[model samples]
Target: MSRTQRVDRTAVRTRLDRVTDPELDRSITELEYIDEIEIEGESVAVSFTLPTAWCSPAFAWMMMTDARDAILEIPEITDVAVDLRDHMHAAEINEGVNERLSFDAVFDDADGDIEAVREELDEKARAARQYRAVSALLDGGATPEQIVGLVRKDLTIDSEGRTTVRLDETLSICIESEPIERYLEKATATGVANGTDAGLFVTPEGETISPSEFETVHRRGRLAATNMSGQGHVCANLAEARIGSASASD
Candidate 1:
């Protein structure tokens, strides 16, 4: 047996960084999730692990597919195999990879309309925003009974200094209380407590809340929990030191 030739594995690894984990929203390379990469002649084999075993199977499979596609694009790569280790549904993921690779052959007569696909995606985005608003309300102090009360009809509240919930066709639920900045602070804090990605940040347009704002709110929530909550307040003091160090950079 003869070894075909050794390829520059570093260059191939750099290309793999282009693949991203959709849920974590980070490049696989940054996450240090790639376990090993073996390049022999025209064949490439890669193994990786997910952050958790219970991560969304569809997302993990799609990411693996994308990663394989990216790697195969490297010159002289004729075959590729991506192994998902320690992730739930590894067998299903392997099946999906094979299916995706053979998709063209399986759907020889199928054709996609890019414009129609775009329109469908745009509609889904609107629906997703509405769903997020509903989920947030449900997850918050609001009860399931309260959610049932405000399902269809537009809901609004005018709480005197208390958090009020309002719903609009466009923005879905809008909680109005105090200034926007203060509300953002509270909301972001709530997000952090829930271990959610929600944050608070000012938008470039000076209107409409952005995802960054929710992240900030979540981080603050974590800080407040560590500081204000009894027994856990000690953690908040430690967090304060970290926050102070971070802010000092600014």
Candidate 2:
């Protein structure tokens, strides 16, 4: 490959960072699942391993396919390959994902649709992120009523780390943008915050949050966040142990 044609390692890692472990709802890269990245001309290959050999095949499939798709999104890249290593079903996942086969086609005995599973996880992630966003707004002095009443048109997110939440015609407050931005990403994905009239924050079922139900709804969101965080810690410990075992064996 010529100088300009050389694929950037950082670019590939940046794209891979978007691929998250479904159960943990955390970036696979952040969890140190990425084992290697090899570039040959316009083709890039990624190898990853999970925290355990028996990690859910569905979750492994999702991460592998997502990583391949994310890397292919780069305009300069023409072909991408994902290799899932160390998992019990790694071979099936690797072949299925590379061949672009459906989950059912790959695993005929699988119970339900993988897309349905993905949607469920995405909703959970949205709820967890919603908790953080709402907490940020509350800490910024916005009331529960104002938050429940917010619509998609009420937020103004600028380039900086500040987001302006319009409580009403005359009252608006600024808060840190990270939480809101993260929430909006998943909210839009799960069809919670799409239109100007759509409620900016909603229940896990994607219903408008009433004032009376705000506390309960917020608590549910908090629980989702806590559950995800707890799973993340468990996965992190398992991954660390795997790494240590590998080092010891060497």
Candidate 3:
């Protein structure tokens, strides 16, 4: 039998608590979403369930990604695998976890400065590619509305057309787009129809609506859609702007 390092269950649990459930805006531990934690030698297996099955597949997977990162911080843990069996977006979670684990392994042995420099270069390269793509899309005669829609639906784009992003509790929107008033008006109409207050809010950057806010607007109508987004909107009113306000604090 291969010898294994002693894993500190408490430390692992504590680290897991740092990862928030993207939909609920609460720690997975507090939500009691994590179902099990199995330790087998150097490998750690985690099982979890989301608030709903149809919620944002990408966001759910992001949570799992965060969880995996947290677990891998434990020294004794050599292999960390996340299993989302009852999760709303199981496939996405599985795929995201695998990708994150692969990435983590790459940086696992790197020093802080090396990782930082590598990340900065990567970000710059990605930004350059994103700008080129957005320029191409605009050159192709894509309407502003179409560009906005693409930004709302696709996170890969980074340019003037992309207006929203989320980092922790903050949410922002783009203001550079012509007819800013019109976009807000559309957001207001969507909010009013959904019985929410202020459907959109400008981000700190003052250039885009936040991804979370965009998601809120996207999921304003229909129970089926709401269920797919997660349980956060259970009693939400899209006609008013309360949802936006509540989301800001979350």
Candidate 4:
């Protein structure tokens, strides 16, 4: 066999950390879904298990593909093998993902295509992250009017991990960068805040939020955040039990 280029293990992990579970909108690495990472020269094999054997097949397919794609981003890594363990659709998902087949092609009975599912999840994630980001700004003494009026150009992030918000010609506020940065990432990706002149925040439907409706939109964002986190907590608990059971069997 031909030898492949050397790869950095830490760099691989960091890339994998960027791949999130679609439903939870959280990192798979943080969710403890990654069971093992094996490397041989430039190729990698990632083995992961979900909280349940019957977890949604579409969700599993998304994660497996995402994991493979993330690892391949490293220039040195030539190939990636994603192994989905102990799931009802593991066989189909693994085969489809490794072979680069479409999700619909592999699972003919799937009600909706993967991209639609992904878009929906992305919208939810954008909303949830927006809630936290807006909360951070509010706590930093920003008002609803100031926040709703923000545009892409009004925000700046520095190397020191601070986000400076230019409220007006004479006033600006600095806040921790993490929340705003995270929100901006999803917001930009979903095209909700894509242009320099576009509003920085919007309703989950991608409409500009009127000042009168800002409170309602914020509340919905909070609910979206709550639902995702609650689901994540349940998955975490179930995953723990599942892992423990496997260990005892061994």
CA lDDT, candidate 2, residue 102: 86
* Model 4 vs. true fold: TM: 0.95
The lDDT per prediction is: 0.52, 0.91, 0.50, 0.91
Q: Which lDDT value does model 1 have at 112?
A: 56
Q: After superposition, how far is residue 179 of candidate 2 from its true place, in Å?
A: 0.3
- Report the Cα lDDT for candidate 4: 0.91
TM-score of each: 0.42, 0.96, 0.41, 0.95
Per-residue lDDT, model 3, residue 100, is 62
Question: What's the CA error at residue 8 for candidate 2, in Å?
Answer: 0.3
Candidate 4, residue 18: Cα displacement in angstroms equals 0.5
Q: Candidate 1 or 4, higher TM-score?
A: 4
> What is the C-alpha lDDT profile of model 1 across 5-48, one tens digit per residue?
55678877887887755433346787666889988788888897
Cα lDDT tens digits, model 4, 133-243, are 999999999889888999999999999999999987888999999999999889977888788889999998989999899999999999999999999889888878877
lDDT-sorted candidate list, best first = 4, 2, 1, 3
lDDT of 2 at 234: 84
> After TM-score superposition, what is the CA distance of residue 176 in candidate 4 from its true location, in Å?
0.6
As for lDDT, the candidate ahead, 3 or 4, is 4
Alpha-carbon lDDT of model 1 = 0.52
Please list the residue runs of candidate 3 whose C-alpha ends up more than 4 Å from where it truly belongs after superposition: 1-5, 99-203, 206-250
